[model samples]
Target: MFDVKIVNGHILDGTGNPWTKLDIGIINDTIVEIGQLKDAPSKETIDAEGLVVSPGFIDTHVHSDLLCLRPEVHKIKVMQGVTTELFGQDGISVAPVSSETKPIWQKQLKGLNGDIGDWPWESIDDYLSYLEQSDLIGNNTYLVPHGGARTLVMGFEGRKATKEEMTEMRKIVEKGMEEGAVGVSSGLIYPPNIYSDKEELIEICKGAARYDGCFVVHIRNESNKSLEALEEVIDVARITGVRLHVSHFKVAGELNRDKFTKSLQLMDEAREEGIEVTFDQYPYTAGSTVFHSILPPWMHEGGTEKLLERLKDKDVRNRIKEDFLHNEDYENWVRNCGWENIVIASVGSEQNKEAENKNMLKIAELWNTTPEEAAFDLLLEEEANITMIAHWGDEEDLIYGMQHPLQVVGSDGIFGGKPHPRLFGTYPRVLGEFVREKGALTLSEAVRRMTGAPAQLLRLKDRGLLIEGYKADIVVFDPTTVKDRSTYEEPLLEPVGIKYVLVNGLLAVKDEQFTGMTAGRVIRSGVATPVN
Candidate 1:
């Protein structure tokens, strides 16, 4: 008898083709058959009449590293039918830590990646194994974090790596890859990742290249000189022959959103010259990040404690204000988007929870002070753990980027107070609003981008498609009613119309309710490669 039989579903198969009616048979965790199975015996049966059955969504960029450690917290993805989520995004993860820098990274990363308090893994293998031994909700993939390795070797020092240091970091990357990391990631907007120049990046990429792993970068800049930043990464990819993947690709400031067309031209040129380049973007105009990130890079040299000290000093705050108001060289997101555009996504303190989702300008008005003073006061009070959302992109550019062939979807949101709506809404919004509502993409094309395309990028041969013998990672949903209910004002709400989700033949979500199953596996590069 088959383990489970799903009959009468219009199967998309995640191949970018039109839907075809088929019955699917599952034995254990593999899709045993894909054709007629009506007469076949089965232990369980699902009538998928009038519904679409497709491969579960693979989130190309997700920051659920520590959140996944808590079982029910992952319902944010499962409710939307995400089967696989690739972590170690924007260049910071919990693993590959050294004894010296372990405490430092744990605190520094808390601004965006929430606390993991005393969890026991330092090396990549140990970290991945810890998850495997835990109660997981969905399949997870990891990338060797460039910043984590840098912290181990450089300790938040804002300087280019010495040749020996670079070699040491290279070994870490290679070792992580050997132990099953799919790639390496660099968050250039966040330092000391920003400290690395082109040559250093190429060196790191080379290690990932050896294992046929992807080199994913959150590029150095997304504002005024965005094209130049794009060029730098493209050249790095060209020189190293690394499979390049750009994370959460967007021209963030209002001043640069119009330049996205030119940016696309540069990427197209790079691809034409034989660089394997792709990018992921959330379908939102507003972007979320730590509010402290807007300060001058020099102020961040010694990490959050020093930054907090600077925030409290009147003279230091004034000097920073002067430089920000006058400097034309550096791309300051706050200045470019205007104070009115910055909204508080969350704060570290319980008393300030009421400030969640309020814009900086509104807070300033409420406190009877300038936005600059209000911001500094907030940072000083919260100790640099305030997160903000900037309303700063052009709708035209967002649509243009989404229509590109290499574009895949990602939710760059994390768990905490008043997060971005994309945290719970990205996949459903793409399907309902982008596909069914606006017809921006056909159901087949959107499904392909969400599933098959990401699978191809990560070289995950077994999980992205709903073919016979592939892993039974599948989603069943109604095309007519699937839509995201989460909004910026009500960010934590779940989605609607996702009927069921399966991870490796086990139901994780059934009829929009979590099945409370821990069927997730810590997927490794090439299916569990051993470290040398």
Candidate 2:
């Protein structure tokens, strides 16, 4: 008898091809057979008559490291049919660290990931080992965080790395990559990483390229100089011959939205010049991140302790206020952060619960002050640690981005007490809202973008496609009924029409509910050998 049989489903196969009817047979953890199975016997048979059976979704950009440590994180992702998630995004993760840098990183990243209790592991392999022993939700792939590596070797100081310090950091990257890390990541817009120059980046990325890996970067800026940031990324790829992937690619400022065509043309021009480049973006019109991201980059050089101290000085505060007023696109930034569109999603301080769903502009008006002053007071009151959303980007910008052949999808949202809905609703919104309802893309093309495309980018062999002898990581869903129920007001609701989600032939989500199963394993890269 077969181990399990999913009968009579229209198979999409994840190749952007036409749907074909087939019966899928699974045994242990692999797809044992496909096609006619009329005479096959099985332990259990699922009647998926009206459902579309395809490879489980793969999330390209994710920040669910600590969130997945909680048991229910898998449920939130699996119910939307995501079987695998790429963690260690935008250069922040909990690996490749030293004891000295652990506490400093925890405080530096307080606004990004809240309240990390303990340092569970030291190296990338060690961190993955800890997750393997814990109750994780799905398969996780990791990358060596360049920002964390810098913090470990060179504290939060804004200085160039000496020869010895550079060597130490490169050794850490080599060890993590040897232990199966996919690549290295950097967040140039954030501190520590922002302090690094082109020489430092090129040296490290050359090592990553030696292993046939890609370096992913959250570009230096996402606002007025976004095009220049894109060019800089291309320059890095050209200098080191490292494959490049840009995180959350979008034109953010209101005036910059008109330059989408120009930015895309530049990317197209880069690809033609033989620089391998790809990008991921969420489908929403509004973007979200910590409110302090608007601060002048230099003001955040020394990390949180120094930032808090600077916030208390009268002269410094006045200087910062003047700088905010005189910013080149200050009005566009204000419009992007519309009071009604900006929501207080999470806060470290207990006093912040009352501010949820309220906008920064409204709060500023209530206090009879400028928005920057209101933001400063709120951050100071909350100890420079709060998470807020920016209502930026136009719908046309998002649609134009997705229509590109090279673009993939990702949710920049991460979880805390209460989080943005994209973490739970991104995949469903794409399939239901854009493809099924709005007809933005055909069903076949949407499946390809979610599954096969990202898997190919990660070089995940025997996954993201349905065929015999491959891992039985699959999902069964009804395209017509699938929809995302989560919104800004209520961000934790589950999606509909996803009936079954499997990881390695085990049911992670069954009947639209999580089974609390934990059978995920960490994926590693192939070994690098010397060229003759």
Candidate 3:
């Protein structure tokens, strides 16, 4: 008798193979058999009569490390059919942080991570061990956040690393990898990390590559500096011979819209030059980040207290606002730039909880001031804690980009209330809308993108496939009904049509409901190439 038998299902087998009729048998947490199973007996039998079973979806980009410590880990993501997720993208994470720096790190990332209770570890390995003890509901993976590590070793000051500092940083990456972090990640567009030049990155990539890990970067900026950032990433890959994964590789702002195709051409060119480059982007045009991210790097050099001091100085505030005025859209007094479309995804401090859905642009208009000044004031009032969805994407660009072979789907999601629906709907949106509904990709091809492609990039062994001996991580859904219900307004709504989701062979989500089970394991990269 089999431990569990899923009978009469259309198996999509994550290999991009042709769909086949099969009965999958699971014994404990592994798929024990496939194909005909007419007489198979088991402790449990699921009559998957009309369901289309595929490998459980894997989210390549997630910011759920600290948030998953919450009681439910937000069942919204699990119910949407994501069985496994890679956390620590764009560099901010709980691991690799010393206890002394954890609080400051938490506060700095509060807008992105939302408020969470105290963390238990000061290092990546310890954090992973603590997570293993948590009542998590789904599979969670870890990445050594370069920003977190840098902040721990050097604080938030923008400076070049000393020789000893470089040694310390390399040790941090090595320790995290030894403890199960899949790779190294950076947020170069954000804080102290932005201070790092190409040579520093090359050194760090070399360390990560020693652990067979990849380097993932929230590339410098997709604006005027997009090409420069791309050049920097390619240089790192070239210098260190590391694998490069570009996070949210979109060209933002209307001015950069025409540069989207050019960005792809650049990446393709890098690939041709033997630089292993891949990128992930959400299907949305507008991007979301902390409002404080717009602050000058110098203003944020010392941390929150220093930033608050600068905010209090009228001269400093005016000087900063003067610089921001050149941005045009936000310079016009009382202009509601993207307000109608800007949904407040998260608010970090107790004082700013009321700003969760109110528009910053509208608030600027109410104060009869420039949007930049309004943003500064709002962030200052909340201690630089706010999140906003900037409406700045072109649908044509999104569609065209997703069609690219090297482009994989990513939500770039924050685990917070009213967060971008991409967190809950990315995989299904690609599977149902883009693949089935729009006919942009064959179902097998889409599955490969969400499953195999990312698994390969992260170098997760034996995952992202449906082979008999592989892990029994699977999903069963109805393609016709598998549509994302979470819209821009009702961003927290759950998706429909996913019937079951398994992580490491245990049902994490069943019948479109969370089973309150976590069967995830941290994946450490074993490649010897530099990970960028």
After TM-score superposition, the amount by which residue 40's alpha carbon in candidate 3 deviates from its true location, in angstroms, is 0.6
* Candidate 2 residue-wise lDDT, 1-532, digit = tens: 7788898899989889989988999999899999888579998888889999999888888877767777665468888888888877777677877888777777666666666588778888888888888777688888788877887787788877887777777777777777787788888867778778777787678667767777888887676777887888889899878778888888776767766777888889989999888888888876666666666666777777787788788788787776665654222344444455666677777876666657876777877887667777787888766777667778877888888888877777677646778877888899899999888888888888888888887888888999899898999999989999988888888889899988999998889988989877777777544111
Cα error of candidate 3 at position 168, Å: 2.7
Compute each candidate's TM-score over C-alphas: 0.97, 0.95, 0.93
Give lDDT tens digits, candidate 3, residues 256-361: 6777898899899999999889998787777777767666666778677688778888899877766554543211111223445555667666765665665766
Best by lDDT: 1
Alpha-carbon runs more than 4 Å astray in model 3: 327-343, 349-354, 524-532
lDDT of 2: 0.79
Candidate 1 RMSD to the correct structure: 1.7
Name the regions of candidate 1 deviating beyond 4 angstroms.
328-331, 527-532
C-alpha lDDT of residue 416 in model 2: 66
Each model's C-alpha lDDT? 0.86, 0.79, 0.76
Model 3 residue 432 lDDT?
A: 79
Judging by TM-score against the true structure, name the best candidate.
1
Which pairs in model 3 have colliding backbones?
96-124, 212-527, 214-531, 215-531, 215-532, 242-530, 285-393
Lowest lDDT sum, 10 consecutive residues, model 2, at 328-337
